[model samples]
Target: MSDTITWGMMLRKLPSIANAIPRLVKGMKVANVKDPTQTCGLGWSFEQATLRNPDGPALLQGEVVLTYSQVNQWANRMAHHLIAQGIGKGDVVAVFIENRPELLVTILAVAKVGAISALLNTAQTRDTLAHSLNLVAPAAIVVGEELVPTFSAVRERVAIEATRTWFIADQNTCKPPGIAPDGFINLMTACADGCADNPASSRQVFFDDPCFYLYTSGTTGLPKAGVFKHGRWMRSYVSFGMIALDMRPEDVIYCTLPLYHATGLCVCWGSAISGACGFAIRRKFSASQFWSDVRHYRATTIGYVGELCRYLVDQPPGAHDSQHGVKKMIGNGLRPGAWGEFKRRFGVNHICELYAASDGNIGFSNILNFDNTVGFSLMSWELAAYDHDSGAPTRDATGFMRKVAKGEEGLLLAKIDDKAPLDGYTDPQKTETVVLHDVFKKGDRYFNTGDLLRNIGFGHARFVDRLGDTYRWKGENVSTTEVENTLLKHPTISEAVAYGVEIENTNGRAGMAAITPAESLATLDFSELLAFARQQLPAYAVPLFLRVKVKMETTGTFKYQKTRLKDEAFDPGKTGDDPIYAWLPGTDTYVRVTEQLLAQIQGGKYRY
Candidate 1:
């Protein structure tokens, strides 16, 4: 029989066979690995792989290929130097560096010493940078020489002692003299005499021990440090790397995202668990050079964010566009519309779209080759209705947790108990705010995932929008993601953000959208774009007003910041710089929004 016939027959017989073999359908395996006391989790696995594949490629930087043995030796030497500097178990070491081999070496070294690593975002300014340092209160800070000015600006406000700061000089790059503070140490000088083969000397770390702290993107407000335990990090690797991406030891993974982000740290780092080589690009993502980099590094796999993917797809197609070796790509936030196009254009076989939060305990992955869904979770979790304005769980008079029906959107929560601990932030109050206790059953607890998700089917869920991003319109909740997705379907739009704007005499907030058109489509046909959105999105969800911008402001993680955009809604008088357009229901095209129109809308004369 032909392959197609055999596949068709197998699909037809699956239902009957599934009923006969219930255990197989439910994914119950008879033989499972029994080792429970494996002290060497992911870190030790990498060490073993490095030893076995010493001559094999471990990291590829342009034309430079660093073997596994070389990386292992450098990490060992760095670990010894760190230990000599009084950094050991339970100590918090802050890392502030870009995506480079040195950054990975530093992380591994810290882990070897049983010390917790706190990776700081290099994109943060003085105030936010100081906030991150104060939250962790690190024993020592290791900063890249390139980011010295940023660190120097915030050094006084950081809680760390002056003597604990260390600056890493990139020898290949220029060195700035007098950039380092008086008491700061230099990493090159400190490790100059350290031996590479020093014996490992550290206490065994448990699964519950804090491994790292990733700060949340402060899009809503101030950034909070989210503590990641060893167990959870390991689990993340298993789910994202092993099950989702199906990564193998021979696969070379390319990461352009910042290392500080969870997707880079947990997902990309987890690729190391498979003994795979990871290629780090020590610069911001450039759409033009993306394919060339992939070809240059011979990368078989790559990780991405939604914006990065969109940017790549928007680039003008070239003869060499599909002439790369990338086979599989994994990350979260790939919009449904661009999913198929990305695969077709890039010639990628697998697009593992995942869903997770930095602080939340629950996670989902696209394992069964499902398209447009964040696939089922292997662990337990729940979803319930959440109030946006109050920022709390909504309950009935009977004191029972109200869960959204199948296919409806609701807040995602993870069951937190002895088996699944809520390894929250250092602040107890912030931790308390995330825990929902005694909701469905007596003494049961759940970790509140602030984002909302909708059940798609087959144990899978699709990301809806963040709770703060969703707003009420005409007694119906409007999902920002849905509106944004609709707006993006228009060929002219490159990016879009949907948010609620307050209006006088309005029972609920009005929908306002900001759009950035493709460069080629700069002379936008607003009438056609508006019509497309109106047909796809619900009447109430359609934007009553639109603002055009050359670009949208986003966080380091590429998430659009709505707080600032919402504050500067289409008040033509206040926001005179950017052109504003308004959509009247009956009009074929959107009219220019002027000060007179803004006043009339505020006076309740204009109806959406």
Candidate 2:
């Protein structure tokens, strides 16, 4: 009722008007388009950059380099073959292959035909492989010859009536399994013979159409398939590739991550958006060969995950460590402890650390050269505190959603309106679970990203930990990342994972730590790490129990999943042969957790 306009009122109005102007103009342009069908999908982008740039390198694998024109021609040939084999629009084709030229070619072929390509994680075991294939119900499956054993194991469990199954081998060979009555084809032969006689199918495709389905870790439960629409894929190309990295058509991108993951598929493929070349690595990441490969391929840019960076930093400093042609690096999950060290050792000029999930609608990139922070978003989104136990947002007294204060950790949510569609998945039930409606404003929708992040000013955010990775200790919230960072500072520790375990009569959960010691520090003085952690972390945050592992289990994407480790806890009796240690409050070092000690602790006879 005051004459003076409050700052909050003025700020709110300004943002809405600011966001609408450009969007309104874009909407009008699209509405007035003379040919609406031509203004859709990757076809538009492909047409903009024709085959005149054919001589430019588009892909590099080892010593081989395929030009942009060659890549497009190969994809077109493959697409024609697929169409002849009864695989066209609306069909789901599962591709099980490693990082190779064939993988990229297959994905492009699938997209060209307006089909949904399900890129299956090659690292998945038989059970997970079966689950993934069953969920997709692909009309056809394309696999590498090396993964024949994997498909053989899960073939009985697959329910889809696949029309064709193909394998790419060293030599063009059609060796179909006995049970596969649909017949087998060889990729080499298929590409050799172009489908010139078959006419192109006439099907309606839109920007909102599903191009690919990327599966996320089922850490909460079972893995859910996340659909990536053509429009969202195009957006990644513009935002991350063009605007963020400012990549040029001549840039050579070194991609070591698996092609099945979203980071490699979207960011790496975004190089193609500018007609840039992508160098693919097939084998597991080797620190010794990392710089050599970069130098050999003359890669100007590289993509990485946190573990990849940590592994490189853990290696002994070589004479050529600082000698590399890599000018920029992009990807997510780079921990704060290794950020500066990685850049200094590798001599990388630009570290575009981005934060996004395979299923997440919201994304953040380091556009402003912010250190240890994921940069701001150009779209609409919100962050709110989420209940870990219930996996939902917390509501206030008036049933209104609460937003997290700046610098506080919260679950990221993206506004899903008509403009920003949440083309979730084929499974509607799984999709509904991630969408929240009528939160801050009535009739508004938001996509819940189950990640905990701290807003680090200037529209930047730093990923703190996964919601499940965080634990309550001594009535205070303890982030696993905070503990992991402190442990990494310990000279003896090589890798570490910190989680919480329920203890008898405990207020909430007690801290537990797992570590893999450096080889040189095998005979490490345990007192040093214990004393260091005690000085660095609070009393409640310091781990009460410890487990030493020679190697830690990680997902294909190199993310450490603590669920199984948390379930194993610190019971020495059940730990098989791995060493377990326990810390007594006043002790300067940790002592072995013997069977008798574990029994006593579980029986409530021992207190620490």
Candidate 3:
């Protein structure tokens, strides 16, 4: 091989470097102009986009194509309608809807009137749904017509008044049913006659005002609502939209992730608004139809989570796999092993791996398109040595947290101050649990991310693992305590311990539970238990593997011991006499984990 490069090769690289300069300049301008005092909210961004490109396409949902001005007007109409019902600044409006155009529109409408939109996760049921709705104490709630039955089932438990409960029609029916359910008014009919003028109240919303609340599973059985301030959304718009992805006005973004998540709501949608781009959305992700949808919409950019990427990668190879127009992707949790293969197979030009929590103050992005890294961080952050067993920061002799050396894994923490303050959760007491004081210096504070990461050099880091009682699965965070509480609710389940176990070829860990039955194993109605789990928790949180334990192990304090159970995992070979049952996909009941089934799992036959 020649040591020196040819002149032609050097000349070819010049155009590549030249093409990035304009984007660099635009990104710099966006960063410099991101002012907290400049009324930087989603509503402000919506107005600016409408003014800049009123005729440009904004939203694409199946047969519908809404322009910027049309979407703005729709939001305005909804805002006026909501204001007529006494919803205004400082008020909270609950939104319980699936991923639809109205979901984002309702959020914007709530923001336009200086009201906080509490985005309820659609996966919740009954008591969990009621807890989330009651947590915010909303002045009103907007429910999708398809979800009306679920909302109606828990209406009595929720505190929203009958007059304030509004129902938006689903895709199947643009109008509410002729006979509306009691205590629910049809929002479409009510807002059809409302004014389309922009509400003046949006001007009162400042940078620090709460804009949205996203649910995150807590240490308890219920989900804790995380505050998402307008200021933070503005930052993401500048950093992720303008800088990292460097989107343009003509770009069309395809987002299949749920809108309730920050990755979809703040990063994906904010990027579209910042660059006046178009968005093609889906109600939910489908691996089989992902590329087809991308091609149908002519999407130049796509959003994903690790699980979605794995699902797409697991599908059998076909001509359509590489036939889509996706040039760039922006998301978190793209596993290191799958990174190169995903890009190579899908022909993605850029992969901007990002890392940030809904309530955390700091974040990282792959601005330089680095491989196997979460890229650079602009804010002050550190990798402090942590206790893996206890899931706590390791203190040095001087009573200060020690930073891990480069390339070593440690706990990720963000310095908290006036500029990088943790927005925290709706429960202030729960907020206090995640904040650590005197971390490195006297009287200093840091926001604990509860995640482990490697301190890769050059300001970049690699995500290692999640700590404490929380584990991520299927792109959603699962709390061990929450699942355990639900499992114990069954009369036949006397003891239950929940933990996550690594599957051979999965994006995140799969949940598993070790339980001691109250009676003979044959007497236990596993199908009924599965039904109970499906009712009490989201599908992702339900344990996939169940170990029938002879007796439950406990610590000196009587706390359930998950260490030994986690070590043994779900492997029947290592579990000794204890039998393991697995909830196979598409199956109604639990089946014994036979050697053949274990081999199938190890060989990656099941696309779990």
The whole-model lDDT of each prediction reads 0.76, 0.75, 0.81
Winner on lDDT between 1 and 3 is 3
Residue 204 deviation, candidate 3, in Å? 1.6
lDDT of 2 by residue, 398-505 (tens): 786899998777988889865556878769998998888888988888988777877766466778787778888776888999999999888788999999998776
Q: Identify the leading candidate in terms of lDDT.
A: 3
lDDT by residue for model 3 (195-284), tens: 877888777777788999988743334778999888777778878887788777889999988888788889999989988989899988
- Which portions of model 3 miss their true places by more than 4 Å? 1-37, 172-179, 218-220, 469-608
Model 3: residue 263 alpha-carbon error in angstroms: 1.0
The TM-score between candidate 2 and the true structure equals 0.89
Clash number for each model? 0, 1, 0
Estimate, for each residue in 1-608, the C-alpha lDDT of model 1 and write its tens digit.
01112345446646544443443232222111123444543456567667667677776666657777777777777788888778888799999988777777777778777788898988987888898888888999888877888888988887777667887775442122334546677765666557877336433655666778889888878889998876676567666665566566677788788889889878876764454565546467888888888887777888899889999999899988788889888888998889889989989877778887778777787665556777777567777977766557788877878888877788888898654568899788999988988888878888888888877655677787888888888888888888988888876778899999888887788898988887643578878877787789888898988888888889877998888888888887766567888876567788888888878877878666
Provide the lDDT at 386 for model 1.
Answer: 73
Q: After superposition, how far is residue 225 of candidate 2 from its true place, in Å?
A: 1.2
Clashing residue pairs for model 1: none
